[model samples]
Target: MRTEGDTWDIVSSVGMTALFVAAIRAAETKQPDALVHDEFAALFVAAAGDPDTNRLIDDPELWADSPLGLGFMGLRSKFFDDHFRAATEAGVRQAVILAAGLDARAYRLDWPQGMVVYEIDQPKVLEFKGQVLADAHATPTADRREVAVDLRDNWPAALIEEGFDPARPTVWSAEGLLPYLPGAAQDALFARIDQLSAPGSSLATDTFGSDVDFQQLADFQTEQMRDTSFGKIDIADLLYTDDRSDPAEWLTKQGWTTKAAPPEELAARYDRPLTEVLEPYAQMFNGMKYLTAVKPS
Candidate 1:
């Protein structure tokens, strides 16, 4: 649980979730025909220097027990990878990754020349990621910029001050972010994005279903996390879990052409099926969609 004074860095609750995802990505990377490959992910885990995290990364059996969860992460990573590739190929040079935590896309992806990738997150999160990549002597494929600010703050101003050009087309992503924000904040985020985006700009995001009994699942997951090797961090504590509007439908009404798909469909397209054990978790993700929307030129 996060206290009011709890400042987040890479190892905290919400921030540590990034490391958890990276651990899964690292595990997937070892497999043949891996959907996504993050070369720097393993390095970040080792750099964390925590015994529990090290155990989670080292023990493949932990991920093997939840094949559906593992597959979902891989599919999600691939989906975002495809999104960025298409965006860059379409000549959208400016890209922003919201809450970019332990994401090595800038370092691993083969971005084109003259592309600028901006990563937005809290100051400590970005600072820690930079330090880890620096220690490993890794280099990004694009001109990467870091915008250190909280999403609840006047982040648009901070982003613009850090060289974001609102007049040009941009590709924006909000992966693993919305559920943590209050409902009103989520709406405000989209409003801000719409204001900053020029015609031809595109956005990609992942959202949870609004109909699920979130409190029930949050309680269940909280108990599960306590007994697991992942430690005592109840992720429920970090999430706002308020009812959020469907981003795809909302974006369409805002004049952007949008497409959405459930995780099952995306997993099948990648030749990875969700396992039976994941059904309970999937229910919580009911109506959960990976969405992409584009403003008309």
Candidate 2:
């Protein structure tokens, strides 16, 4: 369940989803034909001390049973990785990752000189990531800064206080984030981004497909996880499935040129079919869309 003033660390509530993502990334890293590689992923999972997630990572059969496993996360990571690369390659040096949970892009990507990457998440989430990476003696390829604040709060002010510049062109990513926010908050989030974005800024995000039956999907997934080592706590409780604006349509109305890639396009482009998802879930997953938008200079 969610509330207006709720807060959580990496091990509970919405935060545990980050650990799950990291575990998937760790699994993806081990694949011979992996789409994206993040060496720090396994380190985060190992440090978390979650025996069940560790089992999921280690046991091939268990990983195979996951609804969204290595193949899906690999393609998802590749899509966002390409987004960042293209943005930076086009000379946008400033980047902000919204709700950046256990994403090691700062450490793994070969960023250009003078690149600054801002990761915004909860204080404890950031703290856990920082401590884990620090203990592993990992170094980021870019100038990395952590803005420890919840996206549901006044994160724009916090980000600006941490040296974000609204005047400069910025590239922002909201991967696996929108579903966790209420419909109204989702709109407000992008509105805040629009206000802060300079002309020519770019944004990338993922959203539920038009054909999704949110309640049904949530119920199905919750039932599947009920007997898992995760206990009664499931991420379904944290997700918001209310009606919301299409990010591409909404951004276009706000003066951005938007491009959307459906799941088939992404699958074909990457040659990475989501082989792990069950048939029913895969049909649902097929409707998921990845979108990119750019404000005209």
Candidate 2 residues lying further than 4 Å off, grouped into runs, are 222-232, 276-279
Tens digit of per-residue lDDT, candidate 1, span 12-78: 7788888888888887787787898898888888887766666655676654645324577889899
Candidate 1 accuracy as lDDT: 0.82
lDDT of each structure?
0.82, 0.85
Show the lowest summed lDDT stretch of 10 residues, model 1.
222-231
Top-lDDT structure, candidate number: 2
lDDT, candidate 2, 88-204, per-residue tens = 999999999999989999999999999999999999999999999999999999999999998888999999998999999999999999988988889889999999999878999
- Cα lDDT for residue 71, candidate 2: 74
Q: How many residue pairs clash in each candidate?
A: 0, 0
Minimal lDDT window, size 10, model 2: 224-233
